[model samples]
Target: MKGNFNHFKILIVDDEEEYREVFKEILDEKGYITKAASSGEEALNILKTHSFHLVLTDLIMKGIDGIELLEKIKEEYSETEVIIITGYGTVENAVAAMKKGAFTYFIKSHDLEELTIEIEKIRKIFYLENDNEIFKNQQKNSKYMLNTNNKKFIKIINMAEKAANSNVNILILGDSGVGKEVFAKYIHSCSERKDRHFLAVNCHAFSDNLLESELFGHEKGAFTGAIEQRKGRFEAAHGGTLFLDEIGDISLSTQVKLLRTIETKKVERIGSNKTMDVDFRLISATNKDIQKSISNGEFREDLFYRISTIIIEIPPLRDRKEDLPNLIEFFLEKSKLELKKQIHTIEKKVMERLLSYDYPGNVRELKNIIERLVVLSENGIIKDIDLSKYRVDSERDTKSREEKIHNNKEVEEIQRIRSLKDIRSEAEAKYIKKALEISGNNVTEAARKLSISRRQLFNKINEYKLR
Candidate 1:
């Protein structure tokens, strides 16, 4: 099933039937899903219909030449690797193809063995950087930055600050990379404990025993290699804030001890019987559903209720993309200053392309992408054409794009606005229908998510006829 995710495609365009067939056969046997075309025209048509990770074309063609195909493919599909095959392999033709985004040029008479290694390098780029930007920038808003203009973000941040003004435990839940730590830091910085030490630890990074010792400290010769008295994160964070990241990944055995410490506000260090009273604001974060983990026996139900007295679910990047331009400006400035480059001003078209892509990795991914773009961006402008080498490979598949548009229309058309009063009802019905379908129709869960009273939700259910 994991192999299903790595399935890649390659397109071959060659006038020689024998060479085309042999290359396709070799690539197919080597696990690449391959396609073959006899001419550049056929190659273009196939490319529009399906996505390819790489395309290999012969320099000499019967009709519309390979150089033109390279230009079109580079313009249309920047992420797709292109290799040119030529019998002559002249300096003039080689330079032209390379300038037009030809990854490598090979002599047709030579062995095709070197081509595989070249393809592997392109594959690494896909794995490390693939869809990372698309996920972050799919919406027009930058997901990574706090939106000053967004009333929702401002409201949430203000509410979080108010919550931090107290001494209560808070739990933050959101998709990974949603800036849980960002908000945590905001709470800490704005709280009465701003001047104190604000320590944070990733609960998932260590095993049960190691995490316990890290949180609770150890005396001299406690367990293995405990030669001196050690101060735990709790002790160090005393009278301040202790931020636990990815708290959902903590083991069940570790959860019990954590619950005990959180409940008692006391810790007995290892190899010592001294019960240390710890005072700190606990701020835990998880990308997982604590209730689901509790149901699955992976987490304690009592701990779930105890830590989530004040829960904040961070929104995904797509929902608040209106802040992207500001974030892009900030990131570009940072990249320019750090990289010592005179990069300034990105083209509007490049911003449009960035907004059009989905960014699954959230703000962190966007920062990395902007850093790369700044270093690679030519001249003073980061134009769409300059980013031609970094578009999502699937975006080149015109057929799939059309299919997505059609599917969205089909879903939207179902929202029948029977009356002015029913417009809100209709849209709500549509989204509730979708989320329930995606979540397999657990009404209690859906009601909790819709943030509506179960009784009010049932009324809407009856109004919309959602069984």
Candidate 2:
């Protein structure tokens, strides 16, 4: 009565013909689309063919009772709420049903007023959920509204939308700074869990012990400095979405615990014996080649399968260069507002330079570049500035192309030609050196930029004698 009840569909599951007809007739008269199923099996069959907002089922049935039906519905169609219908004698069983995820239970009576009240409550919940999702979408518009024209990226967006409607664990893979976490948040914002907390954790940013405590929480005195009991990301994200960034970087031990928690939907805090049940959609992301990590025994295969029910791979900025102009404009406006600069025009030469350079740090690098330009602009005009000051490798890229052309000419004029393998090795060495330079000679960071394991990069360095 409080909300639009016409959109709500109710399934009445009862073996008794009279009760089924009575429930259906009552709900239909109340303006709810109602369907009747003689048993739990019939209800499940109906569910496969159609969607329902709620299911009203009798606790005592011939086969596949109310509790079993509730479990199946929660396991599959989790968005559908269930209310158990019990006789006076089976009230205890109905209570058990509530513990197992039933919305509520009602005793059979001629009055049937309690049934109508329960349905109204569910409708109110639906109304509130719709309002919350709309509000959240509006709040997140500026932060997550990534406009792209690339066809492949558009398809990825469509796939993400479909994935959002279901309760599936997602794994987003891309290079560093390619907006994997942003995509994860987009999925969360488009999901039924949008109204709830969207908690994110960077797995690569913490030590093994700290990461474990951060994910599973820690009681007071759990460790040397853990003076107070604190809830972890998983607990804090209950009934919402938990985003694990750089998921491939987590240790195998932590992976094992994560796998168990995901499987059981429960977690035990450090120094606490009690296990708390948590329900949260998992959306993990990593720039690393996860298959290589699995082959190298750095990540668990079981955990990978569990978290990667739906995998979304994002293209690097270089591949989707068509979106560069729009992205540049967006970042330019954003930077202007943030820096409080009245910069109005970007020089043609400056725009050309911005478009030509391959963004090794993807969108994030472009944003930084725009912000830097805004900061350096004089007299409200953006003129050609020294890109090298920002560590942009455009000059180095041009020199590399020149050197490559010179090398090709030399190879053609020489009597004895170099083998293809040798040529490839030389090119690879130069690229690795460039990556190292871009990462300030930090081997770990260079490896990440190269999309290879640190050990693999170290082996390549030794093979090329570059270190």
Candidate 3:
């Protein structure tokens, strides 16, 4: 081991001079560049002037204590790994120290053989990780198939690819269901970190404290129910990518921590003084208007700037109607394969209806609509009649009529002429169809959308011959 790792550096920190000397002598014999500190303060002072790959520190020290020293080293020298040594019957603190970012811990009373083996194992891991990163960086560039029919949409994809080639942070702006995560993944797959971890965290899903603990990791005893130390997204995504979805939803306090971590390239786990170094390219997405969020004091402006060094604003489906045909074809094929159906054609009128509607849910909604059509199709071919039952005619037509009514007396007269029951029936039918469309014809989902029971929706579908 010494022959192979002669260049590896190790630091030993112990208040007891004899123990420090003994450890240093063993490490020196093994050909490790060894340094010793009699106290935590001395260790820190040595660290300020020099650097080491690993640290061997006693759990109980006279001055700063091993835990505090571990934290300071981890925060300052994130690349440096620490291993805590404990006296007899202090195994729990050693374990706790491991949770606080120690690479591994050792029993002070034990022989140096076990400690040497652990160090050797860690050395192998470092080599493996470095080799893996190199392999990932050498893989062929990932292909991107973004819709290029719309110039603005094409521009965004092109811009994203350019940003991906660099190590810059990116922020994606778009409406919900607009495939922000997909875009993020595309960037990751195309980036240098293609084969590395690509972890995504939805900021809105967890509470403030939970989110903090989740992103920064936490000690075993960090909070209630934190039974064991856990690595967070940031740690796990080191040398890779981290996609923070719905970033605007994070609380102000968490934002501050996140900003500091991004600036320092370091993170402190909850209930742990240690700050670990993380090297990840962050890609954040949000449907919320971040500018508005900043003005509302809901989001941090400086943090936003740090995150949005390269911003890609995705166009809504409505703005990219030219891509509808291509999108429809893409989704149509996807749905067919997913549903295991052979849908070869769609009627011209059905295509027209699909292309005309303004999809509030964007591409996702369109994909669901195509899937619903495929699931509900009786024949292999999709036709006007099959789509007619699931038409959004009522809602679209109603809006048109309302607009006309506001503009013309003749439209108002026509509305007045219709019976109340007829108007109500029209609305009910339109809403039921909309619900069915949104739910992909799943009775349960349609019912939920309509705020009706499954049985009620079934009854309405039968009564209206909606099937």
Superposition error at 47 for model 3 (Å): 58
TM-score of 1: 0.54
Locate the minimum summed-lDDT window of 10 residues in model 3: 136-145
lDDT per residue (tens digit) for residues 314-394 in model 2: 999998888889888887887788678998677777877788788978986787677767867888888775455654555
lDDT of each: 0.77, 0.85, 0.82
lDDT for position 435 in model 3: 75
Error of 2 at 346 (Å): 1.2
TM-score of each: 0.54, 0.58, 0.57
Against the hidden true structure, what lDDT does model 3 obtain?
A: 0.82
Per-residue accuracy of model 1 over 1-467 as CA lDDT, tens digit each: 01222777889999989999999888777777788999999999998889988888988898878899998998998878898888764646966898778988877777778887777777767864654454224212332355566677778877897898898899998887667877787777678987676787878666688888999899988887776678899998898899999899998887888899999999888778889899989999999888888889988888888788898878776667776677778778867886788976777767776665555656655665676577667777676665665443234444676678677866566465467656667777986775465446877655644434465566677779988
Best by lDDT: 2
- Model 3, span 282-376: residue lDDT tens: 99999998999999999999999999999999888888888888788777876687579997677777877888888877876777678778877
Positional deviation of residue 145's Cα in model 2 after best superposition, in angstroms: 4.7
User: lDDT of model 3 at residue 420?
Assistant: 84
- RMSD values for the candidates in order, in angstroms, are 19.3, 20.2, 18.3
